[model samples]
Target: MSESIRNLLEQVKNGQVSVDTALLKLKTKPIDDLGYAQVDLHRVVRQGVPEVIYGAGKTGEQIVGIISSMKANGQCQILITRLSPDIAVYIQKKYEMTFVESAHIGYIGDIPIQKTKSSIAIITGGTSDYKVAEECAVTAEFYGNKVERVYDVGVAGIHRLLQNLERIMSAKVIVVIAGMEGALASVVGGLVDVPVIAVPTSVGYGTSFGGVAALLSMLNSCASGVTVVNIDNGFGAAYMANMINHIGESK
Candidate 1:
């Protein structure tokens, strides 16, 4: 702004900058011009979050274009969810700051990232369920929450989870990933006091219907504070976990 608006009003009393000059500076706030692929101007300011690019079904060029624009505004730590390995490799070749996760192939920048020590525990029912669980973990980490991953402790081996129950209970939030019968969420809910974010993976066959059965089972859990996100939506689960974990940090 060319004029100091707050100072100008005081100046009116003490005779410094004019009211008209103050008005001119107030009218020149920063605004963003919409691009061909996105109108991602005020995302962080309005929603208390930044724009997240969903990499599935989008071309590499489109991903590059989106990242280019986001970077121009100094908004780093961009996350591209559901990206394939090919696309992730392509993105990595272009931008060297990428982290391609094992659970999901999402790409995240290691720059300008927010940092938080309040932890979120990401657990998987089995090895097959790790992909979605990884997505949740990576997403939470990108959103500036410290993450502790507890992998392959499915309900069939109840002792596996119970062995780590203390670690599980230590988290500010817990994301439980499962597929078969989706019983892990309920099991977790019965164990911890923190919010349980359940994610159902499409890991089984015949009766699984690409994870809908697990999704339903999670949604219908009898546990008191169990909340569920969409099947295979690791990003969504992490976003919720970050939101929950950062509640105190914002204060």
Candidate 2:
């Protein structure tokens, strides 16, 4: 059961909340319709995480309306991914939000304290991949996982990555982001005992084919524990890493 539902049940068991009140809380509407979007109000009850807003292709007003509906329904610690800076600024004016321009993410409410016993590491092959790396970092952190970041340590300078070997080896989960040949994932995968999530970005030369080459390379990685996500999908990679990190947690 979700934490919220469990809390409600506990209140009723302790006689702190009347049965009718508990029933009312349980029977609350599962969704809020705003015409343009059907905001999911029960996702937190189903999944440990609430429904995240995809800010791309959404107007500032529409995003605000969806967030408002979620907030009214008692959803806290919302995350909006692929958000543009302008829209983030507009939403910031109406509600408290921290915008990370590099990651194109807008986070609202205080971040939950990390409760997972293990930490997640996010590594990037090059500085150009920092945007995607930041996306993974922000998403992992928002999901309440402790994150360690290692940036610009691609194969070009293997020594840099080697320097952080101890830190990388310490994480329970590792995310490797790259755009060119996507070899970093395999290198990290071979080194780490934990799972490695590879993310390909659309950052390469003409022959890179908008990350297809890198995606294919990662998909075909010879390393045993390497798995690949969609190109430029840092959020997905982080989500999977968070789940892996929390495998033994009570929640």
Candidate 3:
């Protein structure tokens, strides 16, 4: 259960809040209908993480409205992914937020405190893949996981990746980001005992098919522990990595 639900139940047991009042709160708190968007107010209660705004197609006003509803429902921190710098500027005028242009991610309110000691390693095959890698790093950090970034370590430069063996080996989870054949994920997967999440970026020549080639390459990886996400889906990779990193930790 969420902290709010547990506290509410405790209050009812101690007669601080009437049972009927608590019931009413529970019945009405799950969703907030805004016509344009049905803001999920109870996602934190169910998934331990609040709803994240996808700002690609959303107007600045719509994003602000969702943030308003979330804040009114007691969600202090909000994450907005795939947000454009222009929309970010418009949102910032109303609410103070940090925007990362490279990752196209926005943060509202303070980042959560770290919940575990384990760290997540993010490795990028080439400099062109840094944008996707940054998204993974920011998402993982926002979720309170310590992140170690080893960028431009693609298989082309095998020595560079090998030099970072200690950092990669010590991580609880690893996110390997690459484009142009995407062989880096398999290489890392073979060396690490932990799970490897592969993200294929749209950063290659004409024949890459906008990351399809890399995605297929990762899916067909020979390594045992390698897993693949959709093209440029850093947020998904980070979410799964954070879950794996926090396993057995007290929520």
List the candidates' TM-scores in order.
Answer: 0.82, 0.95, 0.93
Q: lDDT (0-100) at residue 232 of candidate 3? A: 95
lDDT of 2: 0.92
lDDT of 2 by residue, 1-251 (tens): 67788988889999999999988987889989999999999899888678999999999999999999999988877999999999999999999999999999999987677457789999999999999999999999888889999999999899999999999999999999999989999999999899999999988999899999999999999999999999999999999998899888776
- The per-residue C-alpha lDDT of model 2 at residue 82 equals 100
- For candidate 1, give the lDDT of residue 60: 82
- Top model by TM-score, which number? 2
lDDT of 3 at 109: 82
TM-score of 3: 0.93
Clashes of each: 1, 0, 0
Q: Of the candidates numbered 1 and 3, which has the greater TM-score value?
A: 3
User: Candidate 1 — what's its lDDT?
Assistant: 0.79
- Number of clashes found in candidate 2: 0
Give per-residue CA lDDT, model 3, range 1-251, as digits (tens).
66678888999999999989999887876889999999998898778889999989999999999999999887888999999999999999999999999999999987767546889999999999988999999999998888999999989889999999999999999999999999999999999999999999999999999999999999999999999999999999999999899886665
For model 3, name the residue pairs that clash: none
User: How high is the lDDT of residue 58 in model 3?
Assistant: 96
Q: Residues 97-187, candidate 1: write the lDDT tens digits.
A: 4656574455545622566767899999999987787778777776668888999999899999999988889899999999978999999
Could you list the CA RMSD of all candidates, in the order they appear?
A: 5.7, 1.4, 1.8
